[model samples]
Each structure stands twice: as C-alpha cells, then as structure tokens.
Target: MQRLDATDNAKALVRQLAETHGDLMFYQAGGCCEGTQPQCFEKGGFFPRTNDVCIGTVEGYEFWVDKDLFEYWKHAHFTLDVTDGFGAGGFSLETPLGKTFQVHYRVFAEEELEKLPPVKRNIP
Candidate 1:
C-alpha cells in the first residue's frame, strides 16, 4: 500500500549503491528540466526542503517527492526506475556511473486508495 516502489533493476542498483555508500535515499522534483527526474543520494547526503513529502520507501530506502509535485500526484503510485544516461544537473550518486534514476507513476485505483499507505507531509 505504499505510494512508492522500485523496479527490479532499480532495486539491484540501489542495493549495490547502499552496499558501497552505506544507505540511500531518493528525491523527485517538479519542473521542466532537472526537476522532472528522480535523483539518488547516499542517505543524509542531500538536504530535503522543509515541506518535502516522504512518499514512501523503495527497498527500505526513503523516497521523497517535492512538495509541489506531491500535490499534483497525491493520488498516484510512484515506481523508481533507472535508465542508462548521465543524470540531469544533479549530484545523485548514480550520475557518476553513467546512469540516472527515473520515476514512473500511475493513478491509484479506488480500492487501492482505501488503504493507501501513510505519507509524511513534511520533513520536519
């Protein structure tokens, strides 16, 4: 019932990253360029905005969505996915390895919405 999930490839990549970096996290912003994609970082590496939304976790790693984006996608499900490419102007851990993180989303069904997982509305 989580708002966030990850693809097999994403999970594997994050696993490898966590092994090397200790822990990992993600943030998806909203905008025309860099904000459109997801960014991966070593846990605690990036400072989230105060009002960022913690959508959920992938492989136990927290995944946060920008406050503005979360408002637009509050009823959708998000899945973390990865693709081969350099990341858009970001400091994401995967950027240096010729890969970038992406987010795929879908609307939550009526039934699914009834038991949707909780989200942290702000970083606090």
Candidate 2:
C-alpha cells in the first residue's frame, strides 16, 4: 500500500544529507533541467506546484511527483534509487555529492493496485 520507496543506498545518502541539511524533502519535476530526476532539498525548501502528488516518503522525507506525469504513471510504483557518477545538469542536493536521485518504476499488478495507498494530492 505504498507508491514510493527508497533503496538502502538512497536511505544512507539521505541520512548523510540530513546530518548537514536537517530534515529533507524531494520533488521530481518531470521537466527539462532535472528531466524527471528526483531533486532533494532541505525540508520545506522547494515548494510544491499546484496539483503535485505526494506519492510517499522515505525516512520521513516527503517525495512528490508532478501531477501531469502522475496521470500517466498512476498505475506504476516508484522506487527512489541512487546512481554512482556525476549528475550532469541536475540541481538536486545529491547532484553536488556526485550522485543523482533517479526513479525506478514499474506498473502495479492488479493485486498491488487494490492495496495501494491513495496519493495525497496538492491543490496549491
């Protein structure tokens, strides 16, 4: 009953960031620049656009996805993963740390759909 999750690697990175940045949050803009990569921020730093969907959280950090994209991905689940290497052109917190936050997604099975938690929709 979840829409978002994180790999152990991602969780460890978040902890490291939190040590310096305090609480954190994330947004996947689904646009150019970051190009759909999840951007991490100090909690409450990046504001959510109207209609952004709160898919879920990891380590208490809220993770949001652009609503328009959510319409296309409504049936898919997301797992936040970190990759080794520089995040070219990405502005996420992790980008400066030689990492980029990316989403690994898959369509939910019928059984999973039924158990999925409802998304918290933002109205702006």
Candidate 3:
C-alpha cells in the first residue's frame, strides 16, 4: 500500500468531519483537466475499488482507493498537502505526470451526510 502524508491541518479537519458526520471516504477519480484528482466523501458514499490501496486511517477514519488507480497514480509520484478552513478549502496532490489534483473538504450537516449514498467501487 502506498503511504500518504496528511498535514496537521488536514488531520484536524478530517477529525472534525468524522466526529460530526461518522465517517469519511477519500476517492480518486479521473479528471477532465488532469489524469486524476482526490475527493473526500462523507459517510454513506461509494467505497473503494478492489484494486485500490488502503492508506490506513486519518483522524480515526478509514481511507482507501482503487488499487489499479492508485498504482497508476503512484507511478506518477504525487504529493498531497491540505489546508483547512471555512473558505480555505483542502489541499492538492501533484502527480508525477506534472498534473495537479485538488481536494475539497467541507463540513457536512447531518441531513446532508444522510442523503449521500453508500460508497462503492466503480467498475468500468
């Protein structure tokens, strides 16, 4: 499994979100401008693909991604740094292909989190 460096700010934000929402799912998806981007989903969203890597937990919350996707991006050698705040948003990962993937994390109200569907792998 690949390793991820969660900034102190990112950790704090994740902790706050998990405590308030129950859980968080981090996703890696194909992007229009770049190869891929990092997205954080509240509890009740889709899960990771079987080929993804599980990077352990952040702030007591579990996190993982599709193994094939992870490997593709891993070969690109990306780094992530998050910035937390009401309007400051999260961080971005710089992929080995010289593309940048952005991450946005927001506080999801209980009702909002409840409305989201469970996370699952997108097999294509």
> Compared with the true structure, what per-residue lDDT tens digits does model 3 show for residues 6-118?
66666665665566667676666554542355656675576665556654456655556556665454433233435322221133221222333344333445555455444
What lDDT is reached at residue 49 by model 2? 87
Q: Which predicted model would earn the best lDDT?
A: 2
Kindly report which residue stretches of model 3 are placed more than 4 angstroms away from their true locations once superposed: 33-35, 75-80, 84-124
- Provide the global lDDT of candidate 3 against the true structure: 0.49
| Cα misplacement distance, residue 39 of candidate 3 (Å) | 1.7
lDDT of 1 by residue, 89-124 (tens): 567888878888888889999999999866787656
Worst 10 residues of 1 by lDDT: 115-124
Ranking by TM-score: 2, 1, 3
lDDT measured at residue 26 in model 3 versus the true structure, 0 to 100: 64
